[model samples]
Target: WKIEIFFRNLKQNLHIKSFLGTSQNAVEIQIWTALITILLLQYLKRIAKHPWCLSNLTASLRLNTFTKIDLFQWINEPFSPPPDEPEIA
Candidate 1:
């Protein structure tokens, strides 16, 4: 069920359904690209620990691709304050 949702989002966001490739190889490549993109987004979400929905994340990426904005919350790391310096024993 989760995968179905992922594929649906992929088609809607990445337009996989509109793939015009006549060859199996081309179609395979298109799907692979879409999957890789989704996987990257998922990883970003995981690391950032943001509660963003997958489809929404993809849309945000597309919408902000041209602008200089901080997406993914600190370059693939979750938001956290700097650790305290260790005390000398």
Candidate 2:
């Protein structure tokens, strides 16, 4: 079968001795999953903070597919700039 051949080729190409161990493989899988999850969470947080600004800026620069207008206004409304402070005499 193709699956058997694929596994055999993978094992041979990688020069793996045996794929029976549990502890090392489990730890590696957990670490890789955690790293991927952390990266995705950070990305989502950035999107949440300034969806419109980031989307528009990145789109204008051709860095992303989303445009400023494409973002949800309710979620990406621009904050009002702080009022100017009165000058002290």
Candidate 3:
């Protein structure tokens, strides 16, 4: 039941209802983009082994946009840099 709340929160936070596409194709693109964004967020959360909700992860990424937080590292561990703080800092 709690997971239901997460999905609902994501749907609201993404403003999925504001998509004012006039054509079918435009609507499809909007839907797909939203889904893909959610998927990427989930993937990052899973890779990080994080127990927090999606909102937390999204906020963290947004805040760390300037930092060297590597999303690719979780997807590909070998060639990617370790999930650590930025080297420049």
Candidate 4:
């Protein structure tokens, strides 16, 4: 019962009037769709493994450590320093 309704809705919305002459197009579309699905799955798996890839490091540090100032300084020290600035003559 439900399957019939679902098929009717899918046919109406997808405009699948007739499958008589769509075998070739369907094959090509399915191939591209499968390729896209596989690529997206692999990309997401790689991202999941790297927790620090897009995380808020400062928040994680604060949660793990006792002192806020120490964490702040540790994270900011590199950006605060001028790596190779020469002294004034």
Per-residue error for 52 in candidate 3, Å, reads: 2.4
lDDT of 3 by residue, 1-70 (tens): 8767745765665645555787999977876787789888877777664464667667756666786545
- Highest TM-score: which candidate? 1
Each model's C-alpha lDDT? Answer: 0.70, 0.47, 0.65, 0.46
Q: Which candidate is the best by lDDT?
A: 1
| Model 4 RMSD in angstroms | 16.3
Q: With candidate 1 superimposed using the best TM-score fit, by how many Å does residue 15's alpha carbon deviate from the native?
A: 3.4
- The local distance difference test score of model 2 is 0.47
Q: Determine which window of 10 residues in candidate 3 has minimal summed lDDT.
A: 73-82
Candidate 1 residues 1-89, lDDT tens each? 98898778877767667777979998789878888897898887777655767667677677768855455543443245434567999
Of candidates 4 and 2, the better by lDDT: 2
Pitting candidate 1 against candidate 3, the one with the higher lDDT is 1
Q: Count the backbone clashes (under 3 Å) in each candidate.
A: 0, 0, 0, 0
Evaluation by lDDT, superior candidate among 1 and 2: 1
Note the residue pairs that clash in candidate 4. Answer: none
TM-score of 3: 0.56
lDDT ranking, high to low: 1, 3, 2, 4
